[model samples]
Target: MKKILTLSLLFIGLHTYAQKAKLELNLQKDSTYLLSVAADMDIDQLLNGAHQLVKTTVTGTTAHKVTAIKDTLYEMEVTYKKLGMHIQMGDKEMGFSSEAGADDLMSKVIKIMINKPFIITMSKRGQIVEVKNIDSLFSGMAKEFPQVGELQLTQIMAQMKQSFGEKSIKGNLQETFVIFPKAPVSVTGMWTTLTTMDAAAISVKTLTKYTLDAITDKYYQVSGAAVITPDKVPAFKQSNGYFMRLTQATGNYTAKLKIDKTTGWVTESHITKNISATMQAKKTATGPVELSYPMKIAMKFTGSDK
Candidate 1:
């Protein structure tokens, strides 16, 4: 369990950071950044080959869990241009390309898990590339999968503007986002695109009417918890604004951000997410994941030369 322990510690730190992850860079203000990243991802591929491996480790497995957990290594490269982030397929990709047979595999699944690994690098304009991060990516799954919609970055940003108004992004603005399954807590990865690719919807409400926090000469923090309406609570509440947080509640989480004072750019980022959930057992299963912290992300941005 040494690996698990190491991963747990690393993830713990990262998750906490992600809970309040930084939006910093080492480059100059208003510059585009590109980061190279690799990771040790713990994934449960839909049909990880070793049926026997499936037989050994997991207990109380589900058809979907079995279907989802495919033992494998994931690989990928990233390039950030403009304000957009793009991922170029990794080595270990999970989920069936199409949805037709996805449910069929969901039947035999009991329990599924995977550990993903990757490498990360950073660079500035005409600067030498520096390696940034490399570690394990962990994930787990049980049963139920509710269909949720996929939010588009455009829609998300648009919503941000609609709710919060336009500001000159004076400081660093960094973020990571994820979605869960609709039925309860069955979402491992994105299962559906509620809106068309052209019309993808982002969680504007999550980023709405938000106030920015003061920045230290070293770093500053902005929180979504304060700006959101109570109805937006993802788990506990289910209305339109359920996910929105209360106002001025930055005390709830911490985001360790590192900034380059000379140029007001972020150098590196470490995010760790921790969550506590309360659930009541249902007749056939468990209660909804009354979640605290959700899919936390840690990202490092660097300016690009070539």
Candidate 2:
């Protein structure tokens, strides 16, 4: 009877240990990983009482090659392998893909982005330290489109910079890879992280609570819930001579992730976010108009080590 009791205690101890994990990036030099990310967004706008809905989908795949490791930081060379976008509004539809022929201006620009390599420096805890060569790369791409008018080219470059700039890249990387706790955590353990999404026209701050849901032999399942609040709302001048400014914004975010136990990398993730905002349009002929904008975004990400 004593022997059976001892064996039972040992089993419990083993199970407890298995439920705890120290999640940190354990990337090796010379190793490579492929990451695919996709996002679908739907925006419903009531502008001056007229309603419109727009849908957009963006997809990209990139390869991250660990070139060097210094202390707790990893230096990686990242190259875009594929990129595509599709947008639909009412009866109009537009799309572009790097794999497709460069038949249109947007497609030509996307083709130029493929295979361009940049460097990222990140800590084991998934803090992005530096993003290098992205600005220069974009500048080079601008030079390739000489046929475009200076004004149109400037607008295009501005939009690209706003989306793929250093700060934006850091924000995106942190959102995905910075889910680990500072110390080891067991199943049901919770931690919080504050992150920001800063863009040219708007900024949002998110406070997320992450819980370790389950631990398996090969991976850990984690879930997160966040409250998103507007940090900054900048007035944007529309092409039609009106200025649009967001007056009120609130949102909620949720995510589920599967992280590799060995490498601490996210193998799969799904995120859903909903935002409701009020905007005011000024300088219109009929005077100031209030607009209601509600947006929903869904994202999926997958990564595999090669």
Candidate 3:
């Protein structure tokens, strides 16, 4: 009897260790989800022999409505319900919100963006394949700022595109959604994904390794670690006529996420990132000066089917 019980216990232990979960987006057609994200960033820089600190906070809410599912691709209409940003440098503060009136350029732009819907095509594995209708949205914004000169408008459009363009949107979405493993993942199962991000004039590549930590009746807990590497930098001329380029950059990123097992949507997530970088600044009258700084960012994200 003792030997038989030992064998039975061993079989149960093996079965428990072999349990797996398939993580995929399984939302029904016509379903809608609301997701909110908030991020705070702090930057400390040494410039001109002085230490300067800057703080910024950003918050946004988006609604995603599944419109169709064809084969393995899902089409969804995404709309920004709210967006806001606040920045602080020393004692001064500035901010804009979608709830505010169009009193300034930033507020006007926020007003134009609110409630505008764009379509995104995503795979079942949560990869964002394509984004559509963003150009049209920008065209509408241009019409609102008719008094601005064409050259200035072109520059404004270029800057806006860097944030709202299809590629940028795809990259942002993939950070949250493209985290599922292709196959069923057991506890302690690990997978890696590579992503590229555009920051100002620099391109950063990140390779993240994710591990399934635990599974419960309601959610799956996962953790990730990423190594960030900055690509070759191209010098960019600033509005003040000074040129700047990234000389070196290194960063670490980590995230903890709890995802709904039924819908494959993140119920809650926390992410922390730290980056140390050196920038070379040059001008016609001065030699290049290197400024080293460290930036820290903390972000929280949550999603709900309601």
Candidate 4:
């Protein structure tokens, strides 16, 4: 009788531990939320002595409110709340605070970005549909820098968009949404998502495999591993009026996510990216020079809804 009772309790425990839950977006329309991301980059290059080290940290915060909803789609208005950065290279270090004025280039860019409104549309499944209100962003920048020529403005706009506009926004949101499965998932369940991204004029494809690591009363722990490979080699213009081609490239990433159970929102995420690439720079005078770059980047995100 004692043995039977022990076996029965063990069976009940196993059964309870195997329960599954459906992860779905529970964000309500006309609600407000706070989103923030902090990124750190460490760059090493073979330059003078040993290796040159460059460290940079960037943190940004934005407030978002759902303005409209149509069917399963949601339109959100976002306002920038904070933008701050810190950089250190050898003996030189720099910092930028939100109170800086438009006198300097970096300050001017930040000035243009503050309080500006952007619209993002996404589906109930957490897929980003589109990003809008970019033209207004540029228009405000133009007002600040009236002397910049049209061609120069265009180049600046391209770089800005790549760093902070549609692509960056979508990529960040993708990191959160890719882990969600359409159906209910049990512990140890696995899923996959494929993403294509541009890196230094090369199109790279990443295949990420995710696993449901654990499920608690409050949070779901998920883990992801990715393999990145170059799709094709592309030629790009160099800063010194020369041409360069990407020769070889490969990378990998690992991420851990802690998601809120009731809302399906990611409360915390930590991701690390490792990349190795070789580039051939054609010099007008000296034939060509091959350079190898190995880089690492780390990113973190935290958010809350109110």
What are the Cα lDDT values of the candidates? Answer: 0.25, 0.78, 0.78, 0.70
**Candidate 3: minimum summed lDDT over ten consecutive residues — where?**
297-306
Instruction: Give the per-residue lDDT of model 1 (tens digit) for 66-163.
Output: 11111221112222211211122344323311122344322212111111222222222111122122212112222122232234323433333332
Worst 10 residues of 1 by lDDT: 58-67
lDDT of 2 by residue, 1-306 (tens): 999999999999878856668988899899988788888888777755677788888888888999999999999999888889999999999998888664888787777878888999989988788889996546566578778888887766666666677767877888888787898888888998888766544567888999999888899899999898888765453433455655456788889988888888788888887777765666664565644454444334344442
Q: After superposition, how far is residue 171 of candidate 2 from its true place, in Å?
A: 1.6
lDDT of 1: 0.25
| Candidate with more favorable, higher lDDT: 1 or 3 | 3
The best-first sequence of candidates by TM-score reads 2, 3, 4, 1
Model 2 error, position 200 (Å)? 3.1
RMSD in angstroms, all models?
21.6, 3.5, 3.6, 3.9
Runs in model 3 deviating more than 4 A are 1-14, 146-155, 232-247, 280-306
For model 3, how does the per-residue alpha-carbon lDDT over 118-148 read when each residue is reduced to its tens digit? Answer: 9999998888888899875565766789898
lDDT of 1 at 265: 39
Off by over 4 Å in 2: 1-14, 17-19, 232-247, 280-306
Ranking by lDDT: 2, 3, 4, 1
Which residue pairs show backbone clashes in model 4?
A: none
